[model samples]
Target: MSSGSPLLADLIEALRCLPGVGGKSAQRMAFHLLERERERGLKLADTLHEAMQRIGHCTRCRNFSEEPMCTICSNASRDRHLLCVVESPVDLAAIEQATGYRGQYFVLMGRLSPLDGLGPQELGLDLLSERLGEGEIEEMILATNPTVEGEATAHYLAQLARAAGIKPTRLAHGVPLGGELEYVDRGTLAHAFGSRLSVD
Candidate 1:
């Protein structure tokens, strides 16, 4: 029932492309923004532009960061010998939310999907190998999702870990099949981290 202003229609289309937001939600958001104070809306746009311009993958773990290394990597209190390997930056953030881990992280950014033409190099497995070869990492905990591709990626990393003489483990119970870590509860995530099982 909107009057179909071109600017509003374009904004609605752009907002609809965001994940989990359907046509109604997108239109509502567009209308809300259009009704907001101009300076407030412009500030939001500037914030998005600044984040997109400054945020890049961390050089070591591939997590999103504003600098060469992520805040976790730069923290000296984190366990340098223990590294948690996750499928994406979101996975890493999920695990961190549990607030029990004191280890570092390596983000794969994706899982191994042969049907989708994704492989080791595509997920930065080479960079992982290099990190493992550095001899600083003694243990790696795979925190990939419980889907087929996630399982395959974890096993693949296990093989690489064994070849490099590093202990490899997978997240324990509480994470359901095909369920992403981001959606799991904090207590379950903490328990999973506490009960990690060796993959050797």
Candidate 2:
């Protein structure tokens, strides 16, 4: 439903570029911005433009940063001997917020999906190998998601860590912390059962 105004239609179309934003949602957002949040919308547009121009990947960890080195990489107090391998910056943020891990990180950016044209080279394995050769990291944590492609990527990372003489560890996969076994999915239940640990 084009509102007969090309500028309004263009705004809605532009909003559709955001992930999960369909035509209807984009139209709603565009209407909201025009109706009551014009000032805030302008601020958001300015900030988005600035961020797009200024944000670049950290040379060391591949995380988004405005500087050459991100804050985590520049922090001297963080453990240099522990490097966590994650599939995305969001995963890194989640780990940072959820756990007390104060280690360096290597973001893969994407997993190993051959069909999608994402491979080791795309994920910057060469850079990761170079970092691994530096000999500072004692352990490499494989924190990729539990999906098929993620598991494949994690296996490859584990092999890379082993070749570099660093211990490789994986994030435990199974049922949620406070969930009952009967309610858990079949795959999750089976995995948890197979990887069960002995209670102390």
Candidate 3:
């Protein structure tokens, strides 16, 4: 807990909720916002509130959306027969920016982590299974992060895909072990997508 003015301390602690923010960083951000950019801070607060209130998960893909479906899922040009599973919306964006993949996506939003109380139900595997059973998807690509939990999630989804008669493929190892897709370079992402291997 912070020891300064109660409001300033609360602001610093709130900033710490952001990813990669530590105590000092949060303190710096709070001071910067309060002293140097009060208007920006107010705008930021308003935008955050508005966005949180309006944006929600896409009904089909679970990506952030203001509507029921995301733009990719709603686009007719994308291949409805192909679906890529990713650990988060950030990973999906990375792959889209780096590769020529025109398939729809399923953002798990998180991988299986039993210790964290994350499991099939948490990842909405049941929803994915329902989609697979619909016969619209011919191929399912596992693009989960290259972590242990990600690998386990991919393998589990692979079994579900195969049981539903859809081919499941895994991104190639061009992505370093335990590397996150959001941090991977475009070239590496493209190479990994191009060289994806069958997991069936």
Candidate 4:
């Protein structure tokens, strides 16, 4: 083990586990947090612990929520006729920031990857079928990442949307090529949502 305190290195390693956070970034963040006020670090730890303990999948949309239904799903004034299906809660948040898409969402944990052994069943697509049968949804915007797996998942969802008799659409070409929705800027995401093309 390094001579430094185990707590410092442990914090860096833990931070490195976040997606896209490299070792250098994690180390930098760990040092920054260590240099921060005691209350700030403790607050961060407490907030993380509280979120993990209280937050769970929303029953209606499968998005992260502290309650049985997420705010988007339980809102009385939000549009209920359109649904946006994304691959993760992070993507849902990105879209919400980029567009005024006041609709419901379904978070698929994984995309359809045959080689990786990920399929509709593994992605909880059965839940989608049950959701579709509820009868209020009329449109589904597939905002999966622009990767190969994302394309495959979009097509798979298109098939399901067709079966459900709901129109399916894909994001427009504003996002950078091969970029994930989470990485796109707000302007690009808004343009994509405004100019979306039907995938049917």
The number of clashing residue pairs in each candidate reads 0, 0, 0, 0
Clash count for candidate 3 is: 0
Clashing pairs in 1: none
Candidate with the greatest lDDT versus the true structure: 2
Ranked candidates (TM-score, high to low): 2, 1, 4, 3
lDDT of 1 by residue, 1-200 (tens): 36658878777888876899988998888778778767787898899889989999999889999999989999999999999999888888789897599999999888999788888888998899999999999999989998878988899999999999999998766777788999998877897789788999
**Lowest-scoring 10 consecutive residues by lDDT in candidate 1?**
1-10
lDDT of 4 at 112: 86
TM-score of 4: 0.75
> Candidate 2 at residue 61, lDDT?
95
**Rank order by lDDT, top first?**
2, 3, 1, 4
Q: What is the TM-score of each candidate against the true structure?
A: 0.81, 0.91, 0.75, 0.75
RMSD of each: 6.4, 1.7, 6.6, 6.6
lDDT by residue (1-200, candidate 3, tens digit) is 64658988888888988999999999999888888999999999999999989999998999999899989999999999999999998999899999999989999989999999998898888888889988999999999987788989999999999999999999867888899999999987997899898999
Clashing residue pairs, candidate 2? none
The true-versus-predicted C-alpha distance at residue 78 of model 1, in Å, is: 1.3
- lDDT of predicted model 4: 0.87
lDDT of 3 at 62: 95
Better of 3 and 4 by lDDT: 3
Q: How far is candidate 4 from the true structure (C-alpha RMSD, Å)?
A: 6.6
